[model samples]
Target: MSQPLTGVKVLDFSTLLPGPLCSLLLAEAGAEVIKFERPGQGDEMRSYEPKVDDDSANFVLLNRGKLSVAIDLKSPEALSQLLPLIREADVLIEQFRPGVMDRLGLGYAALAEVNPRLVYCSITGFGQHGPRASEAAHDLNYVAASGMLSLTAGNDGAPVLPPALIADIAGGTYPAMINILLALRQRDQTGRGVHLDVAMADNLFTFQYWGLGNGALGDWPAPASGLVTGGTPRYQVYRTADGAFLAAAPLEDKFWDNFVALVGQDANALAKMSPHRAIEAVAAAIALHPVAYWEDRFAGQDVCTSRVVSLEEARHEPHFQARGLFDRSVTTAAGGTLPALPVPVDAAFRRPDRSAASPALGAHNQLLNR
Candidate 1:
């Protein structure tokens, strides 16, 4: 079957996680993604650690099946070099600071004049014209600014650092992809493209919808006091006897009943007790058994409980293996191959052969002269 975006062309002027990940998804959907990098250095992620084949594994993972074109966007003749690609591109994505593209003469206004049907997406820490638009921030800073960090408190009452780049991937990459796809559909009807200003911090408010709803009703709970945010014993992480953790989230009465029975608790008593005290009691019970014990005990039960496994364990999980989630592999520049990181695109839309590796810096420079 032909991929959905078989003929679409993408001009990617982004770096690191958010923009690269967004373009990765587009590439999986069969868009011809051409990553436009700097003259010598490419995406900063190319220099990140855990190298495979002398290039950063992080870069290869996110940039598989994409072409690379190197050009000094800061040069006097930069626009001339980029005009050909822009004129033929259906989408253009950039992650620069608010005014950087405008100053480079590659802003949406300039590029849209050349290809008015282009869907221009700008992914940033903040929106194009906000007070914090030009502020420098990483994933943690954006989550902090979005109030997501405040809600992830540890047992010591301090906010714990997130294990993943939630703000970058969720706030920026996912939103950029969604908006770009929507804009593309809109373009088919109107024959005109749209500009997407995706602000990572701004998009994070949706993750706090429950808190926002409470705040709107003037009944906002304190940090970590909501049901899903560790307020209730019924939906929280508990430490096991072996120091490993079990994520328990028996939110419904039926599941809570199963969990209470499995843990030797009185469901009625737990239901009536204060939430904090109940949490303590549940934690104590959970601590009586090791993680493996609970994992086996909850195997077929509908209690919504499971052992907290590391990434390595997760990669080898039976459920994920059955789903064939990690079946795709991308080759490296040095002929080594690694598992291609899974994106949300459907398998039917993805390229069947995943042998494509990330391109070398400016690997497609000949396209510029053409």
Candidate 2:
């Protein structure tokens, strides 16, 4: 079957994580994603560490199956060269500050006049016309500004650094793709394109639904003191006897009963204890046994628990292997291939080619001449 975005055309002018990841999803969904990189240097991610060939694995992983057009957007003749592509493009994604694209004469207003049906998407730390629209910030700042960083705390009551770039991917890339798809759908009816203003910091509030609800009712959640946080014995990471961690979340009564019973505690009696006392009790019981013992105990039980595994261990997980999440491959310039980054895009919407490579800088520069 043909992919969902087979006929869509995308012009990606964003680099690094957010915009590139959005366009990567588009490319995987069969959109012809043509990435416009700066001449000579190309994307900054190409220079990042952990190299696969001459370029970083980060760049190739996010940009596979996409075309590249290297051009000097600062040149006087750049607008003329880009006009043809702009006129034929269905979507344009950029990550510059608010007025940067307008200064280059490539903003949504100018391009929409050329192709009225173009969906222009701008991804940034702050949306256009906001108080902090022009602020220079990264993923960490975005998460901190959105009140998400305050919710996670270490044992000493200090906030912990998030393991992943949540704001960049969850707040920026995912929202941009959703809004871009929405804009495309709207364009089919109105025959006119729209501009999408996606702010990474702004989009993060959606992830804190419970926090928002509680805050509005004059009861804000303290750090590590929420239901899904480390507030309850039912939802916590407990250390096993062998120094391994097991993430436990037997939240519901039924699951909690089964969990307490399996942990060799009286479920009814433990349920009556104070939250902290219950937590201490559970922790003590779990500390007597190793991770392997609990893993076997919880294997077929209704308890919602899992032993924490390293990234390397997760790669070899039986469930993920059965799901074929790592089946697709990405080829490097040196002809070495590795498992592709597993994305959330569905199989039916992805390209048929399982093995694909990222473009060399300006590899499709012939399109500029056309």
Provide TM-scores for the models: 0.98, 0.98
- Model 2, 1-370: lDDT tens per residue? 8888999999999999999999999999999999999999999999999988878989989998999999989999999999999999999999999999999999999898999999999999989987999999999999999989988876788888999999999999999999999998999899999999999999999999999999999989887678987889999999999999999999999999899999999887876898788889999999999999999999999999999999999999999999999999998767767789999999988999999998889989999888
Candidate 2: give the clashing pairs: none
Off by over 4 Å in 1: none
> How close to the true structure is residue 137 of candidate 2, measured as C-alpha lDDT?
98
- Supply the TM-score for candidate 1: 0.98
Pairs with backbone N, CA or C atoms under 3 Å apart (clashes), candidate 1: none
Backbone clashes, candidate 1: 0
Model 2, CA-based lDDT: 0.93
* True lDDT of residue 321, candidate 1: 97
Each model's lDDT: 0.90, 0.93
Best by TM-score: 2
